[model samples]
Target: MTPRTGGRKLCGADELVFYDITASFEERTIFTDILKKTAERVFIPLTVGGGINTLDDFARVLACGADITEDSADKRSLAGIFLSYQAPVEVPGVPLYSYLRTITQKRPELKMTARKFRARVGEIAEQLDMDSSFITRELNVGFSGGEKKKIEMLQLLLLQPKLAILDETDSGLDVDALSVVSRGIEAYRASCDGALLIITHNTRILERLSVDHTHVMVRGRLVAEGPGSLIDDIDAHGFEQFEVAAQAAGA
Candidate 1:
């Protein structure tokens, strides 16, 4: 197979680099090697897509140093799990309400029309103390930190996923917004009997919910484990002891 040609006389580095593949199944492995080399050289936001079929494909491409993995929607969407990101990306052209509708529609089990779904979203937005006009705005485009987190909470509540993974939802949020986000989380738990896996350093959000387990991780290693009280201890004393233990173990 012949490799495609492209060129740019770069004085320094480009702001962003995109690598897209249209290789046949037979040529997938070849592009994987190419991607590895490109990742090694490119120091910008590199988004790679095409011919990725499974989770393993994503893992492989990411391991190759691709910054973002672009795969099919269904492949990335784990059926009963909802993940609220710490930093939500903005999609300028997509309306918040439409995006939510499309995602919910992907789950055949979720039976609701676009109109009804819009109303449902508005109700959740109100609960988050967000304006109804936000639904008409572009997804995360110019929203404040609190608004973005609230939008995530809105999605979590609307989806009613069996498991919600919240990644630092409290980060950058003020006290009121934190309370609103926490309430949305609790509503999901109460209504769906859903489980939560909250990843955060702030105990403020946890103070509102009933935490069953706590694990202190340092340098990607779990150094301590305890009940919910561990949160209070960490809040009062800080992670100094845990960090010291992790360092000792590594040494």
Candidate 2:
């Protein structure tokens, strides 16, 4: 595939790095069917990553039939999960009653009496068999790291993407949060036939989520790619092995 920047072909197919930075950030959730539709329109291999916090993210990308796996590992996992669900800011000078009336008109199903609201939240919580009070909370804002991860997992349950590239979903999470996130990923894997590319440095998270492939990056290059067991080898021996190989290649 040829990509022209200012009428110049900077690289050919073999040298090209098919990166999809925009798709990752702009499309917070990648839908598999949507991606498949997109893939039908394109011929070249696609590499995509952004805002991917769960297995569903991977499913969407893979459904597109992309070959290379790409991702950004610098994600604010907990904060992002909560902020994604925050209520919209009230317009200046608009009364709360006006806002409520507008929302009720637009979404009649959510128009609830005081008692109805409480009962509905209670019933939905009961149906899920989870804590009711937690369901009524304002949003995921100001939540702990663990709480944030749980929220992300909840979003994943709702999305169910095909091929996911989790860009640092394990970062900043405590042991329990890590376990919860891992279990959520495992659950997703169990329920679907999708692939996962977990980009993380934490082995704790890996303990629960099975890894089929592992790739190492150094100085913006994928220096090594191998099976899931490569993670254990790297943890035990560090990147020294790859570094030596690189030095030899340079020599």
Candidate 3:
């Protein structure tokens, strides 16, 4: 499990580091001790994969101080979201339409312009049953928790990251609000071929999602993985079984 550090001397005291697991499963142990030592020293950006079949493997990887979490969603705004949908490869200091025209010559499938971008975002807002004006509001000012989540969904629709990691987006919503959020999520799913990683403690949101896989995390590690039906099972049986399984896995 020799780390391909890309020539970055990890032994040096640095505030940040990125570690990706690339080898087969049996070699994971070679990394555990190094990560534990490094974690005691600095923050590590980690990705663990390869031959990790069970949730227990996820738990062990994270347990080796590879766990990481983030909350950058609050800093992103609705206007910013819309702006991200604009063509990024466009020529600098040129009108969006001009850059769009240039892009169209190569990829004729794209029809982009500043006007159409706004129209599309507005159309999405309307589909989510939201006021178009709110997209330009001062972020989440004067909005309820549910509204904030709705705006996040709008961002998800427009920005469309390669992997959408929604961390408890359904936390404080009422039934109606939950339905709206669910609809927005379904819309986003339909709009792209991207991946979604929904992190949550409640199963209410699962009612509308076409979940491919479900994983339960204990502490900061995944402890179970199953089909969408696992959501119903968890709802009925709770995390007692998962908690025990996690303990056993760690032991």
Off by over 4 Å in 2: 1-132, 247-251
Clashing pairs in 2: 24-50, 56-161, 58-163, 58-164, 59-161, 59-162, 59-163, 59-164, 60-162
TM-score of each: 0.69, 0.53, 0.57
Give per-residue CA lDDT, model 3, range 123-229, as digits (tens): 77888888766745555556677776776677667665445777777777788878988997898788876677887788888888889998888999867788998
Candidate 1 colliding pairs, count: 0
Best prediction by TM-score: 1
Give the runs in model 1 whose Cα sits over 4 Å from its true position: 1-73
Model 2 lDDT tens row, 1-251: 55545534466564323334334455544445555654564445565544345544543454457543333322222111212222222234543333333433333324567566456444433433335445434445455656655655554443343445576777887676677777778776876565666767666678765678888876566788878898889889988888888777767
Cα lDDT, model 2, residue 249: 71
* Alpha-carbon lDDT of model 1: 0.76
User: For each candidate, C-alpha RMSD in Å?
Assistant: 11.5, 11.2, 13.2
Q: What 10-residue stretch in candidate 2 is worst by lDDT?
A: 74-83
Tell me how far the alpha carbon of residue 163 in candidate 2 is from the true structure, in angstroms, after superposition.
2.4
lDDT of 1 by residue, 1-251 (tens): 12223422344554434445646787554267876877666555456645555555655665566644244445445335578989899999999977988888866667688788877888888887899899899999999888899899888888787567899989999888898989988888778866789999878898888888998999888799989889989999999989998888889
Q: What lDDT score belongs to each candidate, Candidate 1 first?
A: 0.76, 0.53, 0.61
170, model 2: CA deviation in Å? 1.4
Clashes of 2: 9
